[model samples]
Target: MTLATAAHAPEGGTTAPAVRIRDLTVVYKTPAGELPAVSEIDMDLPAGTITGLVGESGSGKSTLALSLLNAVQPPGRISSGTVEIDGLGDVVPLQGDKLRRVRGGQIGYVFQAAQNSLNPLKTVGKQLLDLGRSHDVDDLRALVSEAKELLGRMGLDGARVLDSYQHELSGGMRQRVGIMLALVLNAHVVVLDEPTTALDMITQANILEIIRNIHAERGLTTLVITHDIGVVAEVADQLAVMYGGRIVERGPVRSVLGEPRHPYTQGLIRAIPRLTGDIDQARALPGRPPTLGTIPERGCVFRDRCELRMSVCDTVEPVLERHADQLVACHAVAGQEPDGGAPTDDGQEQT
Candidate 1:
């Protein structure tokens, strides 16, 4: 399937976005001083649409997700940025009870590795009760009913799954449980991190379908974080590419995938092995991604591995600029084609 034709919400159409992230920068207090794990990032999760944030490990995808709920732990803080939710204003300054209420109340999060995130010691039902109690749900029966309904909707016997411990359920079942917990609180905005990490190809496809169905059915705004580009192509209407903590590209999934401008984005797409394409055409990127400490203090963070790197890339960092239908951050691309030239057979943009 083409990236643009995923079963997702209509493109460029959203009713008062559910979440708006602006100038978001999360930093970790390391011996080398405050190193950024997520740099000046800006994104929007349109009301009732799915926006996928794709990148390799250590690309700050998870850090950006945590900033949504302002849940970045100590030593790591949302140094600068504003995360504005629909009902809640800028969440950057919210604290204590107010912040707690927003998390899981208005926004639900399905963390990476749903199975590991669950409590092995407690049965699913017991944990669900704990969640309700923490939120001060007055009617325990009503809450349980909602949980059961959600689980049943996902095609599982709610009662049995709830009675089972974390170890008792399979990986896919645990993932569905995670989704149930996130929605059981009636959250309108959901953040799913690596929703299909360890699952086989078949299970991954199943989970993606469930996500699409539930998102459309509930009219929810969703942000899906994954390292896999295929996952984004499967369910996201809009796509954002992150590298070295910065968002280098973003736009409608179809436009961005059809003609990627950024070298990093092109390289990533080129690396994916296609069933019909020549196997030898698929190739890996030249160098490894930069680590936190190794990230350049100045200049482009991706220049070290970029084949199209220029002298300016070593001195000035590229800023996000509109290129045709997508936004790209690359000196090479910006200098070459104003329209972000189409991709060639090799996947690199035709100069």
Candidate 2:
């Protein structure tokens, strides 16, 4: 299908964001100095909508996702910003049990690599029960039954899968189990970080289907952090493009994918391979993505690689500004395009 048509399109009417992050900056303390992995980000994941955070590796996508649940490990901390979940209030200051409660309950997490995240030695039922236990769900039988029901919903044979170990299932089944656990924990918002990684194309499609199905049935607010634009196009209602520790572009999935405004976003879309016409024409982006240690401290972070860079971009950092349907941070995009020069599919100025 097309990116414009999501099976579970976010319903209009909800004005409040399920998760609102304002000026979020995450810093990792290194021997070299403080490294900002996420810098001054302002974003909103609307209630009951699937918002995709897409970028190349080291673009702070995972860092932003972890920050949502306050799970950023030591050495990396939320240096500043407010993380407000719709019903939970501000999480920046929450600590101890309060913070623990928010995690896995209010906000569920599906880490990358299901094989690595699951305990290989533990039975599926045992693991699910342990997760439930953490959320004050102590009744073992009840937890197992609930887990089975959730697994069934995810297309697994509830009883058969529950009794088995992680190694017993195929890669696709394990991945779905990872998703099922997140839903079973009863989280209002689920953060899935690269859930489709290490899977074949068919398996990837299956996983995406599972995600859309679960979201539709549960009405859970979802944040899918991925590097694949194609995957985000298939599953997300809205798309946010992150680069060099900041959100460079964000809008409705169709709008951003159809007419990307940011130069980095343009590069990414240009790089996606088309199956039919001109399949070999896909171009690779030049240069590597900047890491926390390598990114410069001032001005525009993407200036080094942007082809549309202007002299003003060298000295002044471009704040994210509204342009049509999306928010973009780039001097080239912020300036007015001459009349009749519309944006192309890859966000280039079309004469």
Candidate 3:
């Protein structure tokens, strides 16, 4: 499943998508009712770069990742949308074997917690060799040796580590194996869901660099789902800010992280604990985001939390609108301000 093998994959005669999704909606069919996890999300990630999806815990960032693999983890399912893979073919309402094929063959995932993800009973080398064998890779001896070299590249013993169990390796080392497995299969795209969250800052930096290098050298597309602004700053070319199951802002990473068109986006950046902030003067957002299970049906879901909420926000669900180079889904940000008298960020009437 290494990148070298991905290059020669049966063309299936079409182009490659790396991953393309549109109008994707995932909803959990709750006993009480339904909880929308992701709504009307549209995203396109091509080959050779990483797109970062940033948001708080319930912001549905991880849900979007699982949707790609059709591994919606129950109580949840993709309600609608199209998920297409470029080189093989389109798999919109993909299901059964079609979805399974798309997952391992073209897409791979690095789970958030590698320690728990690795099989406790199996040795690391056995796992790698087995995966290679399943993919019909011919070189058993060479692949087994390569696993060691790969571990070495990540600062571990190729052979010694191979015979070790998941619990035996350090946190950082387990994560390294998780990453290697994702790329070793030469997956066209790797969905890294908070993959570095468990590592220390130093280790996190190293992992991100590894991912960056892999993308550049292998032309692999990556989708990094995280909430850490620093992580997005380091690896993302595109950034999507999620709130209440919707993408509130998305565009060039620089613009979204720097200028930050939406108030929510701004508040998030302002709340980051910067070293430059007064030692005791860390910033904070005023309120909480909406709960996915019981969100208000109408109006902006962020209204209760938004510093710039207007009366109109109580009734209107804002549509995604283009502003400058970014897509912002906010009535105020889209300039459909309420009462022609919506309060500004400073709580003053517009001139």
Candidate 4:
């Protein structure tokens, strides 16, 4: 899909947006001081498409996802920015009962490691009922019926699965249960964090297919967070690459994957193992991702690992600038022409 098609609206005409995030920063308190986990970030999840946030473990993908529900916990807080849902204005200031209602009512979250997120003490049905009660669903029988239907759609025996405990289900089954719970409330916006983390390749493929099918069937706005670029490439219409708390690159999934502009994105794509490429061509990124305390206070966050590091990178951080269809934050690519030629000092495109 083109950038305009993927971002502004899906195949159909313009629709109300599902979520808009702007200047969002989340920070955790440390002995040293407050450190950012997510920096000034801006993102849009169009009403009926999936937007993927790809990054390493410490890249704040989860934090950004949590901010959507205003669920950031203690020590860590949404220090700044706005999370505006279509129905709910800015969720940054929502608190107490209001915040609780918004979460799972309008927005559903399938957390990372679905197996662990479940309460082992309670059966799935009991937990589902508790969720209904918490949300003050008047027709609980109807709620239960809806849950059963959703589970059935996911290829599970709804009655038996609901009666069984978490341990009774396989990894893939638990993941489906999680998805069912998230959607049973009839939420319009959904967030799935590492939805297929520990599954086998076959199971991962199955889960991804289910996600894509359910998302389209429901016409839901979805945000999928994953470390695997392949996952995003498979299921996401729009892709955003995050590193060191900032989005380094974003664009239509096909455009970004076909021709990655940011150095970090290029390295990530190069690192992926391919089915037909020469084995030696697959290389891993050098060095480890930065910890919260170790992130640079200024300048480019990826410069330490970037091959095209320049003097300008050491002092000035490159803001996300449009380069054709992609928005890239890298000094090396900042002034490049749409056709990919860098401008020379004399204002001519370098050959």
Question: Who wins the lDDT comparison?
Answer: 1
lDDT of 2 by residue, 1-351 (tens): 112223434454143237878889999999988999999888877777889999889899999999998878889999999898988998989999989988887888987754467888998888888887788886778878877887787778989988889889888888878887877867879999998988899999988998988886777789999988888999998899999999999888998999998999999999989888897688888888898788887789998888997888878888776677677888787676533233443342211
Instruction: Estimate the lDDT of model 1.
Output: 0.86
lDDT of 4 by residue, 1-351 (tens): 233545445444234347888889999999999999999988778678888999999999998999999888778999999999888889999989998998888899997754487899999999999999999999999988898898888888999988999998899999998999899988888999999998999989999999998888777889999998989989998899999999999888898999999989999999998899698898999988988998898899999998999998889887776676667888888755545433232231111
Better of 2 and 3 by TM-score: 2
Q: Report the lDDT tens digits of candidate 1 across residue range 102-140.
A: 899888999775448788999999999999999999998
Best of the two (1, 2) by TM-score: 1
Pick the winner on lDDT between candidates 2 and 4. 4
Candidate 1 deviant stretches above 4 angstroms: 1-17, 339-351
The backbone clash count of each candidate, in order, is 1, 0, 13, 0
lDDT of 3 by residue, 295-314 (tens): 77888878888878899899
Candidate order (lDDT): 1, 4, 2, 3
Local error of candidate 3 at residue 231 (angstroms): 0.7
Scored against the true structure, residue 10 in model 2 reaches a CA lDDT of: 49
Task: Give the Å error, residue 59, model 1.
Answer: 0.6
Ranking by TM-score: 4, 1, 2, 3
lDDT of 1 at 119: 84
Residue 202 displacement (Å), model 3: 1.0
Q: Which residue pairs does candidate 2 place in steric collision?
A: none
How far residue 173's Cα lies from its native spot in candidate 3, in Å, is 0.7
